[model samples]
Target: MLDLRDVTLVGESIGGVLALTVASALPDRVKAVVASNPYDYDRRYADGVRRGNVFANIAIGSYAIPIFGAINAALENRLFLGWVLRGGFYDKRNLPRDLLAEFDRVGRRRGFRYVERKTFAGWRSWNKARALYKNVKAPVTFVYGDHDWSKPA
Candidate 1:
């Protein structure tokens, strides 16, 4: 087992969920946690955002399958990457082109797509982390962007 005493965890997006999970599980060891845009699926539904559902699960799950995931691999190229990032940010025009190019390059590497799909599957498992997040005794802070796509209505 790894010793995690006095650790401060920092994460953004889905990573925020991971930081919270770690902090919750090792409350005595974790010193603090900082998260930005933590993905909370249940909260999204409760707030009537209406994105995640059984069908969405099935669709996201399909991406983890080799054959089905090929489609995602193709679609994740540069053209769509900018569009996706633009939708995530509050200001689309201000998005950095170099960042998008880097993301496109990293995303094209083999197995990145598969791993991404698996990460999406993990998002569906947020309820498990959420349970831990609720029980966390460690100090934690969460930050949110003004136009986060996951914002509840």
Candidate 2:
């Protein structure tokens, strides 16, 4: 905790939920938290954020980009790792190459099995967090898109 910085825990989408866990874990250290398109996963599952190029990298990209690292944790399988530009972001030539490079980096690591285990592990578990949210004592900021659930807070 010595390295704990008094910075805003800005969690975008599910990251928001994770940030909540961190803040709640170290309530005294966390100054505050910002959640965007975040979900109360302890009570509900928020695995429905499939927009932007992010989803393509996490969901469809695996199987579509077979060689890419896509982990279906539940099934313990990896696929092509296809990427989809969400919410009209799919226009060609405009997609950023840096994003692709990031995916490639993530893909090269797992090769499939590794990704699957980690992905599904998160889905099937993460319960201690449930109790944490119910009793969160820190100040929180929540923001969500009217049409989308993954907006930045």
Backbone clashes in each candidate structure, one number apiece?
0, 13
Q: State every prediction's TM-score relative to the real structure.
A: 0.78, 0.55
> How high is the CA lDDT of each candidate model?
0.68, 0.53
The local lDDT score (0 to 100) that residue 27 gets in candidate 1 is 88
Local lDDT at 52 for model 2: 40
> Which digits, one per residue and each the tens of the lDDT, describe model 2 over residues 68-112?
433342232123233443332434565466776665566555344
**Candidate 1's residue-wise lDDT over 1-153, tens digit each?**
787589999998678888999888778888989988777665422221124344343444456567766685566567755655565456668779898899889988888876775566554577667777876778888887776756764
Number of the top candidate by lDDT? 1
TM-score between candidate 1 and the true structure: 0.78
